[model samples]
Target: MRKMKLPESFLFEAGPRAVLLLHAYTGSANDVRLLGRELQRHNYTVYAPQFRGHASERFEDILDEGSPDKWFADVVEATRFLKEKGYEEIAVMGLSMGGIMATRALEVGDYIGGGSFNSPIHHIGKTRLPETFISLYRSFNKRMGVPDARIQDSIPRIKTKRTQQLEEIAEFSKKVAEDLNQINVPYYIASSGNDELIDPANGQILKEALMPYTEVTYHEFPELTHVITVGPNRESFETTVIAFLNKLNWKEG
Candidate 1:
């Protein structure tokens, strides 16, 4: 039997209050599907949209079509899509790069409030993401039967482009940091102490930056890796999310 291809985006509608979930760098909407289902079970509608150029087998698609600007536009569009569905009480969150996108949206988009799970907000100076993207590219091509030698031959060019793309994220993070005063709303942030891709210190960097102007709920999970949504202590993390959502007055009259 042929394997069925999973969708790039997913939605779970359960209630009037909605949450938009974002995926990680080089990952599809699937990254947040599990957490979205959990949120849905708790009666919050969940929608996870695939970033532009993501879920594509071609690495060039991501390099050429994906960037902070384009993905942030995608984030805004996803929230609009939710609003059109009649969910007026909307919140947005994301994993990693998805979290960065969520932060940008919270700055200027329509949201009651939102946060990120292991997102690189203030600390984008140097990231492991470029290498992660390149590794994924190589491994994906290898899975498609590309020769290892050929895959290696393409690594240098991919790395250069991927590094340049990462610079876009760093630039965006800098912008968010500079304009932190614009985000005068509730926001959630979580960090994995064991995270390897981004410095865990980013949680502190973000809180210190946002706390002066916003009501920030911050957590650092010592044992969890970069993806805290599906970590071992996910139950507790989910509970924290529930608590945050419950505190929000995100309802229409």
Candidate 2:
């Protein structure tokens, strides 16, 4: 519902191929910068936008505006913007909650040549979060000690009123996965075997759902927990990602 001004400093590479990097909840464009840099090294124009209805504004605020439908619209608009700029071949990638949004976007958006998703939230089922999760999140937030107005809410959880919407979102995502298979494009997906935030079973669901997409590559880092794929295993993950892009023949457009 609102736009976070993209930093002019985020230089999109001089390439015909474009990649949109989406970040997770409470995350900003900066969070995806490393991934963008890597993609840019391959001559890809990168556009990583801030999603709508963020926890910074208020945890509950995201509930009102960050619906899957709105996010899908946002991604389409972003893709079209890139297309107008002469970047024809496009790919979209997202992590954590953003991954969930990407699927919905891919289902309805156009001009997507391929994509990658790391730690995607394919399903937001009944809240099964443990108390430890809440504690750890709060502790980390406190320790980080950074002031982010948009994400100043209490410990995050699935907003109660949004349960119906989440269920619908899951269904929409499932359909998106099916549609992804029909498209003749290469996809790279990475998941952590020990993602405490999302059930590992969800990873299985994603793998199974995307199985029909014949040109798919999946990697699971068993030792990587939740967001650790971008942390401890950063280099390895980046290597896999570069390989995936190379395989797709998505070099600098």
Candidate 3:
């Protein structure tokens, strides 16, 4: 039998609340599918969209399209689509880079009841070329070769070291740091003290940003790595999320 191609978007019907899941840079809908399944047990209708340049490329190609505006637009479109489908009680969640987009979505999406960011990249913060990180990136770029300029121009742009795609992850960092006082919504942010991919400082910056928000909760796992929240440490992570949701009167099915 011939295989059928699934839509770039995946929707899971469960509870009354509709929760949109945004995966990290380079991750496909599959990356957050586990989280979606978990949320379903809590009666959340999950919608995870495979954003542009994702779900069908190497990590490098996906990163090539990693502009804030692009993902932000995808989230906006996804939220609008869900709203049209009668999902009024909507919440947004993302992992790593996707978390940044989730925050931006809050600005434009209607009726965002809540949000969560796991191992979020709040700010790139003056890259100063963390020698190791830059070296790794450059090495990967060398292996990946240069991407097509036209293709790169097709997505929403962000600022970076290059003249192209200038949404500059650093700009997101600085803006959030200065204007964190403006976010007035319930948010749950989780991080690991030992997460090498995203510095602990980033999580602290997020905490400071959401401090003024009435229902903000921050949890840290000192011994886990960037992806640990999904694997071995997931139980603790899930427990915290449940408690946080319960504090807001979020119940399971």
Candidate closest to the true structure, highest lDDT: 1
lDDT of 2 by residue, 72-145 (tens): 67677777777787777777777766676665555555544444444444553433334443443454444455
Candidate 1 segments exceeding 4 Å error = 1-7, 124-126
In candidate 1, how many Å is residue 111 off?
1.0
The 0-to-1 C-alpha lDDT of every candidate, in the order given, reads: 0.84, 0.62, 0.63
Q: Give the runs in model 3 whose Cα sits over 4 Å from its true position.
A: 1-8, 58-60, 63-66, 116-167, 176-178, 249-253
Off by over 4 Å in 2: 1-11, 55-57, 116-159, 162-165, 177-180, 251-253
Ranking by lDDT: 1, 3, 2
lDDT by residue for model 3 over 195-230, one digit each (tens)? 666566777767776776545788887876665436
lDDT of 1 by residue, 1-253 (tens): 1233644798899888999999988888888878888889988899999999888767567888888999998988898898899888788888988888888888887688899888877774456776677778987776667788988988888888888988888898788778778886799998888898888888888888898898999987888888777676788778888889878877644
Q: For every model in order, what is the number of clashing pairs?
A: 0, 5, 8
* TM-scores of all candidate predictions against the true structure: 0.94, 0.74, 0.74
Residue pairs in candidate 3 whose N, alpha carbon or C atoms collide under 3 angstroms: 15-43, 158-165, 158-166, 158-167, 158-168, 159-166, 159-167, 159-168
Residue 151 error, candidate 3, Å: 18
